[model samples]
Target: MSTSRRTPVTTGLVTALVGFTSSFAVVLAGLRAVGASDTEAASGLLVLCVTQAVGMIVLSWRYRLPITLAWSTPGAAMLAGAAATDGGWPAAVGAFVVTGLLVLATAGWPALGRLVARIPQPVAHAMLAGVLLPLCVAPVRALVTSPWLVAPVVLTWLVLLRRAPRWAVPAAFAMTMVVVGIWLARHGDALDGPLLPHLALTAPTLEWQAVVGIALPLYVVTMAAQNVPGVAVMASYGFTVPWRAAMATTGIGTVVGAPGGGHAINLAAITAAMTAGPEAGPERERRWIAAQTAGWAYLVIALGSTALATVVVAAPAGVVEAVAGLALIGTLGAALHGAVTAEGPREPAVVTFVVAASGVAVAGIGAAFWALVAGVVVHAVVVRRASGADAADEDAATSPSPTPGR
Candidate 1:
């Protein structure tokens, strides 16, 4: 009996850790890339982890579905863009709240959620593929810069993922650390930096211009780019949950954690789908319970200590980047396959992919919004015409039958 109960719990915990470690470095790197001070970045990560865990727990328990929550990676990427413009941390927090509200609002409207649900699978897959493509490309570029450091880790990750899917993320992370540690020892880089982790808190202040202009756009991108695709991924895995409730939970968590410096909280599409899919559990319903457990565990990690952030920063950059890229390979491949393979809608899907990949922004809106728009328009024009033709044929087929009966 003890072993029976312990087995699922252990598996759940290990699965959560895989997701946590796989993306944790990217979260930190995103914070740093956006000009957050180390203290601010650490705080943001803590808040992010906490909110993500809470949302996952609440939703998973209520719906009894393996619904995992996560910070919007696209939102993080938006921050990277915002950071390039010297946006302040407070502004970023404000953006998170605004984005949370937008997600909440969209989720609140059942019609809108249904409408989003109506988006053709191909386009959604294309968008997902487009969003993740850059991540896949990044590791290869990083290898070029630090082949000695990143090559072994990447090769090992590929091997482990092929042979031991469950152990892949943790194994790659451990291997990367070993390689980096060895390199540092040989190169004599400072092994001992500040052992004590730094903590700082900031009061939330509203910046209307930044909120409306920067924050709003950030929210839009996070939802459209991250959350929508997340829903699609879940559906693909045969786990269906109400979009509004998911959005509401995500929003509430984001709002709660905003003061603590978290960015947009949204459904985790790719990684969560990977873990909660049939691969993670024998029964479908059990996966939701696992996700809820993961949420609670994440919250524990968030509030526990600064040691977490310290360890993350101490890891070699190449190792972290390579691991992230490698961990996402499965997801990236699925997204690519889905995006490029839709019947009769290939052109529009391809258009969406290219526009999103362009990374262009206009009037503060991110590329993702535009990509959706462009794809929708093309699909509407093309697919609508095809539908009309089909309707006309049906009408012609039945037309003389009424007259004969008369």
Candidate 2:
């Protein structure tokens, strides 16, 4: 193939490679945190991959835009922090289903999408920052607890972070594989049973807490952090994504994958830049080929989900988590910056951050949902006071009070 054609294919493959390798650990960890068994987590991984791949292919082909899709990394992080619900794994699955439905609703109802857009940016960022805090700190705690195992991973990450930068997380993951292999070699019979992909579906059962705690938060984070940014990224590259169609595709994918352990899928944000930008070749019209290539690449990656899950299952407790933590540090920094930088909502954002980071779950609802509540409440009060003050000042400025002095 000519370089023009070959460039997008290679870029697309890289998009898939980087997207999958960098965050799949977090996805597994997130699924496990929400009460999925090892087999279930592996199943989630498989379905997440397959569904996203299919979504990307369909969207890119149908629209002829580089409309890539991804599993919700932020949503996964939120899940990692969330405790199991009263209904257990089934409830989590139910939350996933609800989240998918909400996404579908957003596509069907413009008002719903508008409501999501109305969420204060600082508050949204704060909630994500808080959800990510516990996971991002894992490397530090892991280093203290298991220095020998985690040190190499951290060092590799640091080195690559300064050098290649984009490959840092994936490289750290590679180091983790090395460390896991060595540890496994040292202790024979660590891994048992087949390491092959398979599905493990569970019938979903909804609980109010899980719906409020998990589904609501998942939908918000996926929308705010992934889908919205994804649309912007494509636009920046001179392509307007079909927002409703994209949401419909991802919502259906999420629902189909839910019973089998997947959390949620949405448009690709960071990876979208790679596939849609000049890196995919200077020809804007042809960049959709990159997304198509990425779809196929994700399918290829899916074949190894079970094997990777087995490794995660067998690795030393802190090792895989350490890699996951390393992958998220950049995201955590971005979230923090976004959370505190808004002038109008800074205090409310801080309040949200404190509450979220506190990890306080009230009445069985997770901290993320409560964080938004606190932020919005504080925001409303603050905005109201500010508006009242503005009104008073305006009245004073225009009033006849100075007539007495005159």
Candidate 3:
């Protein structure tokens, strides 16, 4: 095959490989945190893979653009940090459904999209950073507790970070697999039950707390961290994403997969560049083929979801979390930078970050929801005072009395 044809195929596979291996653990941790059983978490993983695959295939083929979909990684981090809801797994599933509907509504209602866009960027980033804090420290915690298992994984990640930056998380995960294999060998008969992929669906039951605590925060995070950035990434590569179509596809996919434990799906932010950029091919028109190829590749990866979950089930404590932490370290850094660097909202952003990282639940609601509330309140007060001060200064300068006094 010629280089043009091969590039799309190869890059498509790489994009899928890197995207899936790098963060699937985070998805599992999120589902588990929100009260999913091991089987249910595995089901979530499998269905998320299928839903995103379909979304990518349909969006790319229809638009003739390199548009790939992914599970909302930042939203997952929020889930990992969230306090379990009063209604348990069913409530979490309900929250997932609500998040999907909100995404769909955002596509249908221009005002809704505008409302989301109005959120201060610093506050949003601070919320994400706060949610990621505990997870990002897992490698350090794991190293302190289980150096034998975690040391090699961290070393592998560090070495790869300097050389092949894109492959760092995947390589660390590969090393973790080696550690899991060793653990299994030492403890024979560790494997149990079914290893093949299967769905374990939950009937969603809406609870007010879940809606307020999980669904609302989840919708905001998915929109701000994944969908918006994904559009920007594609645009940076000279591809204009069809916003409504993209949201409709991802929203519908999220709704369909909710019963199977998938949290949410949205545009691929990190992998979008790989699929849409010049790396896919010199011919811009043909890059859509790379996303289509990646869609098919995800189906192949889905076959291993159950086996991967099985290892996670049997692996030593903190091992999977260590990998998850390493995968998120870069994202945490980016979120923190975005949180602190905004000129006007810096103080309010810090307040948001501190509140979120506190992990304090109030009246059955998680800290994430409260963090946004507190940040917005502080922002309002600060901005109001600043504007008032500016107006007073302007009035004083223009006043006739000041000229008479001089």
Candidate 4:
């Protein structure tokens, strides 16, 4: 009896660990990239994990949807590449709250969904690509500096990418663990203190920079990259997602957790494939059970975040960054393709991409917001200029060309 229960429980728990471990470095790198201290970043991770777990459990049980929730990985990537805006982490928290409110507003008014949907895809894709471009260089740089250490992890990711593409990042993380373990054992260093929950909060303050730079962009990426695709993933699995309530659950969860350093939470984009699949269970109706188990499992991760935080700090910087960079390799490629492939907005998208990658800040706002603004203006200007040129050429071809013959 015990073995039977333990078997399913273990599967669910392993899924959660995989989920958490696969993305935690991205989250940590993002918080630090956005001006969070180490303690603050760890606190954010713990709060985000716990809050997402709560949202997942409640929404899954209440609606009986296999709702798997996650932090905005793209949003975190944006933060990782972003320059700090006014009020730093506190303002970022403030933006987080605004983002939560915006998400809730979408739930309240379905029209907002349509409005959000109108954001030009090329621009969105460009913004993400720009944001991710800087941080994705870490693995390459690490290879230059610590080839022996970083190569094994990168090689592991490459090998797994061929056979088990889904497991590639986690596999890289595993290889990193083995290398770091050996390094630690040889050095005689140990993680200090018992693993447990700890709280760190940044007092929220509304600032224009945070609202425009952090909140708006954060909301955009979460919706575009995570929630929208996540809903599609659920639909593909033949599940009916109560989209409004699902948005509300994630939004409200973010609101509650943001003051304590958590970033936004939303429906899982990637992990939904795991929890909503045949591997989760044989019966479709029973897959919510897997989601339930995942929730409890995430809570376990929350509890151990302090120790995890210690491990991250104690390890070499390249170690964490190499894995994070490897994890984002696929995302960065997709973003680049999506941003530039479209004919209409290609010029503007490149403008956006360059501004964002350059990491310039203006008027207390980060490069991301400015990048969007710059792209839009440039796109409009170029389009209008091209239209004028086309009109002039048509006039010349139609009427004035006879002078050349004379």
Candidate 5:
């Protein structure tokens, strides 16, 4: 028997599985990069998956919309090499809490969200592209370093992309799995880490430096990079997003997951497209089934957090990075196109991209925040100059007409 609320089982399952396999490696690698212990990273991964699944179920059920919630892939990317300037992982946890609160505010108060909405999209897009630049380059570097393992993965991705686009990422993952199996067979499962996940909470600590350096940037980037476009995606699919409800769910979810090392949660853009679109089903109203089913499927996958984390921890750094980077290539290209498509803001967008991609930090803050600020400055100056030129032209045109009439 099937429910009207759930029509596509296989679609939902694939969405959930691909969502985890394609990016879970990046999430673990990011936490480790930001100084989290393996156990802590495992906890974070499990908690986040559970949190997002719960959120997706809640929002989709309540609103009767195919609202897909996701742990912010871009946020994790931003935090990849960022350690708390003040208290390390605990401080990063604090930043996560702050980011969640900000997201809540955006949902609860439409006015504030509208303010965020007013931010120029080009700047946001530029910052996002810059943030993803290094990770996107990892595949090329991996090929240079370890051609044997990487060639197959990259080749599978390209061939599948041409042959069966939807299967490309999954095939890449399968190739990696084959490699993992070979490695594990050589070294038996005698690892000290438990196969099952156990959550360990880190007490949140706050410092001015942490707030400015980690918390602020995390909040802004997640807002611009994830949440803003997320709702837009829903709207494009003709679903009326209950702003407060959507924001509240993610904010609460983030708070719950953060203490367990989860970074932040937001509405899914890419994954949402998969689950909410026509490919999920022929009927638009019934597509909610896909998101709902995918939500449940994610919960099932969450059970293997420890196993997933172990594999990521054991894999060579280049291999982990290469896989993660390849997964994000499409995202990087889309973001870059968004950043530079408009003639009006091209300069500012470039400024933002360079500042962010350069990875320059100031005071305790990471490059992402400074990148936004730099872009805004450049945008303002250029707009001002253009405005002045327009004014001058108007004055000259008016004076010439007056002289001719006289």
Candidate 6:
């Protein structure tokens, strides 16, 4: 192949590796939060990670856009909430299908897509910040229970993040493994387990209650709270791709992976932005190939679920938390700046961010959806009134015939 083609392909592989490594901790946490049995959760995550990688590759290749696919982090939170109400794996999958359909529908309708696009940047940023705040807090909360285990790891992560942002995660993981190994050795914990691989397949079962109660809500949260912003992030990076096609790719991936208990697959915004940015490559156009490489690498990970989960489980919790938090610092700061910097929209954006971070759930919907609703109402009332007043003044000035007659 020519030098130009080879460069994208190489950069694409590197992007995938970096993206997957950075985000894997979050994925593992999502699985555990939802109470998946060790084996089942491992299998499900394997499916999710692989399918996402594949979808990213296919879509990037097709559009020649630097679009990277990832499992929905916010969607995982919705599933965690649903699981709290006794929704099982089947229910989560059901929710995935519902959300996939919603995304598909949104993409199919040009008017709706336009409406989604028209949401103010401040509002979108607020929503993104709101959705991510909980994730940042999860590790801190974990620290309360396991300070001995979590503290050293977290501190190491912070220092590494400050000194070497790119290597922070991997460094934290290494430190965590060392800590765990030492602790295990001191306590004489058994390290013996089947070091062999096992394969288990789960067939999809339809559950009506799960569909309505769990699946629908999850679908809505994933698409609205997660995927929409994902598209916006891509656009911000100067890559404009079709949302409909991307959603369709996720839907099809969900369908394909459903039998193995995968929930949903979608575009990754924050993490993708990290890899597709100047950090990953010298040339802009080569970024798409990075996403493509990530997709294939994800498939390799899926095939090795047992080994991967074991590694994740073995890592100290603090290490994962601190690294995830640190990696997200830049993203969080950007979201906050966007949310609060706008002159007229700051109040509404603040409201959205607070409501989203409150972790409040009413009628089974998450804070992300509610935040958008609240912000829009405020924007409409405030912005429309100002617009109306301006229109009235213009009308008064232009009323020539009445004055002339008088």
lDDT of each: 0.68, 0.93, 0.94, 0.85, 0.81, 0.66
Write model 5 residue lDDT over 1-406, tens digit each, in one string.
Answer: 6543344666788888888887887788777766689999999999999999998887787777788888888888788745436477888788888888888887767787777666678888888889889889999999999888788889989999999876787788778877766666777744557579779799988766667766676777777777777878878778777778888889989988889989988888877778777777778877877888889998899888788777767765577788788888887898899898877848999999999898777776778778888988998999999999999999888884445555
Q: Write the per-residue lDDT of candidate 4 for residues 28-80, one digit (tens) a residue.
A: 88888777888888899999999999988898889876788988889999888
Put the candidates in lDDT order, highest first. Answer: 3, 2, 4, 5, 1, 6
Alpha-carbon shift of residue 350 in model 3 (angstroms) = 0.3
Model 3 weakest 10-residue run by lDDT: 397-406
Q: Write one digit per residue (lDDT tens) for candidate 3, span 121-182.
A: 89999999999999998899999999999999999999999999999999999999999999
- lDDT, candidate 5, equals 0.81
TM-scores of the candidates are 0.77, 0.97, 0.98, 0.90, 0.93, 0.76
The parts of candidate 2 lying over 4 Å away from their true place are 402-406
Which whole-number lDDT from 0 to 100 does residue 346 have in model 3? 81
lDDT of 1 by residue, 77-187 (tens): 445434232246666566666766766777677665566656666666666556556666777988999888888888777788789876777787778778877876877
* lDDT score, candidate 6: 0.66
Best by lDDT: 3
Candidate 1: the clashing residue pairs are 65-288, 66-288
* Weakest ten-residue segment in model 2 by summed lDDT: 187-196
Report the C-alpha displacement of residue 228, candidate 4, in angstroms.
1.0
What value does the lDDT take at residue 134 in candidate 6?
Answer: 67
- Report RMSD (Å) for each prediction in the order shown: 5.6, 1.5, 1.5, 3.3, 2.6, 4.8
State the lDDT of candidate 6 residue by residue for 47-150, as single tens digits. 78777877887888888777887776655544443333345555555555665665667667767556665777687777667766767775687678788877
